[model samples]
Target chain A: MEMEKLYRMHSDRVYSYIYLLVRHRECAEDLTQETFYKAYKGLEAFNKQASTATWLLKIARNVTYDYFRRKRVIKFFSFDKGHDLETNALSPESRYEQKEQLARMFATLSKLKKDYQEVLLLRKIQECSIQETAFILGWTEAKVKMKMTRALEALKKEFHKEGGHPNGTIKRI
Target chain B: MEPSKEFDELFEEMKEVERSEEAKRNTWLALKGRIATKRKRNIFPAFISLAIVAIATFLIITYSIPSETEQSAESLSNEEIIRAVLEREYNGPDKEHLRLMNDWMKFQSERNAKNQEEYDELLESKEYKDFMNYYQTTFGEYFTENMLTKAISTVMVFKYHYYLEDTDIEMHLENVEIKQEKDHPNIYRPIIEVSLTNSQGQKIFHTLREEFIFSKSEPGKIGSYNVAKGGGSIEFREKIENFNSYVGGNEDVRTPSFRKTISFDTLCFNGKIFENENTQKNIHGCTSDRKKINSILKIFDHLPIKEATEQESRKRAEALPQMDNYQIYLTNEVDKGTTFYTITLYEDGVLMFAPGLDLGILGDITTAPHAVIYEKVKLMLDEFSDN
Candidate 1:
């Protein structure tokens, strides 16, 4: 029961973070499960300096990074999964605009370099602190800031130069 | 710490990416099954029984006896403090009074010069009395016996104020920083960036950095709240929460480790790269060849640089590079990492692209007081440019 509760509390964030890296839902799910398995094994040594969520993210990042390091092959991660959760907007038109903007945002995000994508996702989207981001990426805090500045510039430039969305919508899993 | 305002909306949407319930359930079930197979908490039943008994005994011993002192809010973790603030159970009236006090501060400061006599006069003034009466009437239930300490119910406005009564507030806390003033061990300055919006077609902002000092004597009360710009109100620094502290939690939380200060680092431009706002960095990669670059830039060192007028400085600092200019970026690798800054050289002046800002120059002409008049900056670029 305790394990299920912990998974329920944190699985989505872990999955989403992994998904952001892999851009594949099934693969992200598998990796997330792997991350938990690893985390459970190491649970006895968990440090309390950071929050449980931050610790999980740190683990998830390593699990994902290790997967890439082992695979070394860049799969063409197209945004072909076309499903979105219902928007809470009162107006249908606003909801559609919100959905389209989100789609456009994700599409633009996909175009950046993988490191840029991770920096943007972790810092800007996930809203981690410089310290927390450093902890997750295993980079120094200054590196995180520098990467964030560069990543924001690249993302902004890409956002301005963004054209049609050839990659289909995100399924939001 | 944040992208510019335009990205805030998109980030808000992106953060709403929810794992579908189906996927979450499947992942959870799969993880649970695998974990059960791997460990199953082997030999844990007796240990679990011991832990439960110990916990129950500890709880009974801790909470059963009547204690003279209540727990201090300082003992709560940052998460608990935020959660307590969000609970709205005891904080509704407390926060509302804080708003009242903040508005009163604004009103009083606007009306009078911020001297002690003026403050005392304001306190006796009819407006002050009316404000006091309004606070008492609205929040008397929380602090009927005591009138001085405003946040008796817990929670204070801190470094910045919110016009809470003017609008309904929906808040999301992103981070917490625990700052301490030296020699005052009991004072905690917990800073947080809060995203606030109003439900009633009112003023809304994306986020705000609010820092408030929590006193051990009286938790959730205002101190050093002089947010009014240019207002040197001495009374603003007065400890407003001198009342008794009350909460129920652990007694010795020991002021959750002081926030980490970013160590001063060896940086480029004699640490000029560190001046960019919003980030405290420890970078080691100064361009080893800067002496070579600066030697080429020696002409401007002899120019009647400081004689330039404010207009000239402004124009040169902000002006676009002349058409006759040479352009090159002096890249200083940050911490030997891929992140580096580019310093631009023009025929007339030098422009260093300020990191953490959009296409603006802050430390121009090598952060010189005057703009460049000589071609030596371009010569400096020429000495190094690939072209």
Candidate 2:
């Protein structure tokens, strides 16, 4: 595909994946650019084996992981206070309840193992098909299915621990 | 088994997370520019490598052949053959010269290989990767990729002053907020809070929120949007305090205390302007233009004076090249209590105003205003030459 068309088709999914991984707007934006730049440079290496979106997301995932490795020391000491502040959607008073519930769920998700978080985000949140998730993650379709099952169970346990019912409603303890 | 409703709701919220339209546009522009530059740069290296190979081939051909005199005289050593050839071609050929040439070539080849390895490693380095990522995110469509890289040796903090139709504005990274849209799950908005200080010293602040929608699927592409301005306020002092506290405990933070203020009655411009210094010209006495002092003073007055963080001061000290014998002197009456301040002008046209007594304060006059001052000074000097 032409670079422009490729960018138009997949940039958002790529960017959102990076954002979910890094949880920083500036960092996510940077990683997204890096992913595309890498895609552009490595375009010759890209075979038609997987869809373009999966390839882009794979690059995005690697870029974000590279960032995490670089920032591991800083991350250990500092809680990312800026992550929750990134979303401007809940500024309205009416959406406060929903926003709080989402925040709680996100908090639970964030505490999960990195791989679990990745599996759930790709399978459930991004709503990627098992094959696409496998392609992007460089995993087998069977592994993605197994991981998704385990991730969903882990998320449910964490949510319940956080006073959330299995139905997804939050109960303030 | 079906995914629970709670998981679905959470996933639904995650689906709403996306790149703003403005961000998408900016990233596309940045990516396009980067790709173009990469193409151009790639071409140049190919040409360079080709030229290098051709030159190496020519050198090998020319240097490998033994001369008739050497062949007739005796079977000479490689060093002796080189010496004889040098002596015949030029005047002097010492044993040391052949050794030096061999050593230099060996050094050059080794250095070249080392440098190539380092460059390759740097391409894969985390710092370089982060730099590429940050460059696109921080500047976006506002700055070209090459502009950020022109001076790789120097640490430059770019402050963009955007001129709207009626209002002039400046935004720091601290004031920007990015969030998902509540009503539309697939959209994200980046709202920048702008604090405008009017002539009366009263501050009027407003939020410039993005109006365009962005889809979660293609978060990098920003759609068209008008800025919705809303009422807000900026607490400048509080922000400064917070910044100071953040960097306070670190020894690298050079928190210079305020020293006594100095007043100057006269200014002098000296050193090489075009080629060499014509003469030491006094701005107060040389120029017949009555507004000369005020014009110069206007530039000084508008300098962005602020307490320099330790990181900024250190970066400035390291990055700035050694200045030539350039000096701008300010003097006042002895009884009137005069102060002399030193201003460092960078090759890139950034001026750092460092007051006397080693005041921890550093004033930065960005390139635009610094250019204005430089032009004004040159014009004043040209007037002197005309006479």
Candidate 3:
């Protein structure tokens, strides 16, 4: 596929995945660019065994991990004192509540082990198939299923601690 | 049980968080530029080969041009002949050495450029803009132009340092209210509420009530606001039960190690100097001495020490048995608030300095003004020890 076309078709998904993992918008953008750059460079070697989306995502995952490795110690915050989390205007009250809950959920998700986070993000959040997740993560189907189960359980427990009931009811404190 | 339907809804909401059109265009442009650069780099080997051929041709031409003087020059000593040849062909270092130096310089330039790019990107972020907006909205009304700028800059420095080491924590501005002090009607108190949550589900609800004591002469001017006297308290809440105990008792948590320690001799604190127990002495100095001590204390106050990962703490424990020489101490009352620094310098040249245990793992003072502080302390100790 042409680089521009490939990017146009899948860049949003790829960017979103990376953004969720790194939780930094600018870094996500850079990593997305890096992912495409690598894909463009390695386009010839790409075996067509996986879909282009999967291939791009695999590259994205690797690029993000490489970034983490280079910055072995991830800095929690930059030195600029005026930093604040981005906020958008609320339309309906319910939408605002949902957004807040989602933010809380993601914050909990970040606490999970890297492997668990990767699997759940890819399979559940990004809506990648089990096979696609396994391929991206270099895990077998069985391992993906096994890890997914464990990841979900861990997430559920975290949710429960955050006032989320097992029956999917969330009580906001 | 399967994942909840609420999770599906949350995931759908997450999809909405995407790259904007401008971001997409920018990313594509950047990708294209990088690809073009990569293609250009691919031709570097060909250029190098061509250069080698050119050099060979030049050498052949030089060697072929024979003169009666050149013929006679061969009769000189081997070293003399080599010196002459080198002087004729080169003004300084050989081509190979120059090439290596050029490569090293290029590498350094590229790394610096990458760092600058990352910093620029960070400045352009929405979160940074929001932070600036918050400050401007809250303080802009009362601040003089210069005072506002200085206040924002000071706050930015604190925010930057705080966030750099605590990226896992999310900061939310809960509220910002401007009110008058109870007795002092003219004095404005901007009560800012900020909520912070870390990855471990621990939350800190902080209420910063700043007493914006404006000058009587310039009633609402920025310079009038006294920031030095403002203070706040943090209220901790754990979303997860026993989160503190988990973080505290569990030393196996994995934390990043950014600073690396190097060798240093001598140690100094305030007026006391210690090279060895017997060599320790008290020293007095001019006004600049106090300034220097204050600077060192400021750096120590911001040392990036965090709790070691459980695995790291274990590894350290195992290694401690082998580390026979290590010195740990607290500085004498640096101020009235009982503020002191804990410094652990090992025989193997590792130094771990921090203000207190709750702040996190003791970090190496290997970077920047901190490194400068270390050197100054060392020099002070050396001077006193010599005396």
**Tens digits of lDDT, candidate 3, B1-387:** 566453676556555665579988998888876754553333121212233334434544554454455543325432233233223221221333234334534543454433334434443443333334433333333445444454443331122223223245545544444555678755665545444456775444344444455445654353444432434322222312223442353333222222122212212433344556456544432222445544434444433334444564454445443442233223333432232444543323234545532121344331111222334344444443324
At residue B185, give the lDDT of candidate 1: 47
Model 1 residue runs over 4 Å out of place are A69-71, A74-78, A82-85, A88-96, A163-173, B1-3, B40-387
Taken in order, the candidates have interface RMSDs of 9.6, 5.5, 5.8
lDDT tens digits by residue: candidate 2, A37-116 = 99987776688787777878888878777887787721211125664533555555526556567777777887777678
Which wins on TM-score, candidate 1 or candidate 2?
2
Every candidate's DockQ is 0.17, 0.23, 0.23
What lDDT tens digits, residue by residue, belong to model 2 across residues B1-387? 354454785577667665689988888878877864674334212212333334434544455454453342234432232233222212212233234334434443454422234434433433333333332333222222332232111212111111211232222221333455677744545544334343333232233344434323334322233333431112322322243332233333232222235545555444333333444332222333436655655545533344456776776666443322233445554422343665554433345566652222255323221333444445554454422
Among the numbered candidates, top lDDT falls to: 3
Q: Pick the candidate with the highest TM-score.
A: 2
Per-model TM-score on C-alpha atoms: 0.35, 0.38, 0.37
Q: How far is B172's C-alpha from truth in model 1 (Å)? A: 66
- The RMSD of every model to the true structure, in order and in angstroms, is 29.8, 25.3, 27.5
TM-score between model 3 and native: 0.37
Taking the tens digit of each residue's C-alpha lDDT, what string does model 1 give over A2-93? 45556778888888788766777788889999988787766655867677888999999888878988999543223556445458754786
Q: What TM-score does candidate 2 reach?
A: 0.38
